[model samples]
Target: MGGEWFEVLRPPYLPVEIRWERAVADGLPADVSHAFGIFDTTLCGVQEAGMSPSDHWWLPERESACDACREAAGVIDDRRPRAMRGEDARVSVARRL
Candidate 1:
């Protein structure tokens, strides 16, 4: 019954989408199909049954997200290109590690 919502700022496929995930019980679902179905069901639900307080229609309060989510956002933000011509691309990738 107890679970935690973690924000995924930079999913591998879509870097710009703000996504949230629920890690309940032991951990997240290992199967992609299960994960997708679970997430979709929760998100598509009405009345915000299992949704987080910050989970609005379009605006989510990232600052209020859990520490893990915040950290992920930071990591993603850093890796994203900061300039048009990749001026900041020269930055060492090791920083992410």
Candidate 2:
């Protein structure tokens, strides 16, 4: 049988079932719980959503997203060009110095 597949990600400190609450506690608008279903599939359906290794989902359009996630996305976005040039390691390290 074929079935649609989905992914859900949540921080470890928060119960997986109450991930939405964690989003709210983190200062994101409460409506976010409804804006995107509390899963990566629905989260990615929202424009410009980002998933982190720590199992957090962020909407890139929202200024209210977790700072570290947004900044991490920004760092990755900033590196795309250097990566395309085949010099990501050198440039990424140089930028940190």
Highest lDDT: give the candidate number. Answer: 2
Q: Write the per-residue lDDT of candidate 2 for residues 4-44, one digit (tens) a residue.
A: 23322221232223332223233334444322334432332
Q: Model 2, residue 4: what's the lDDT? A: 25
Q: Local error of candidate 2 at 18, Å?
A: 24
Over 9-38, each residue of candidate 1 has an lDDT whose tens digit, in order, gives 222332323444432222333232111114
Q: For model 1, give the 10-residue run with minimal summed lDDT.
A: 28-37
**Candidate 2 clashes between residue pairs 3 or more apart in a chain or in different chains:** none
What CA RMSD would you report for each candidate? 15.5, 15.8
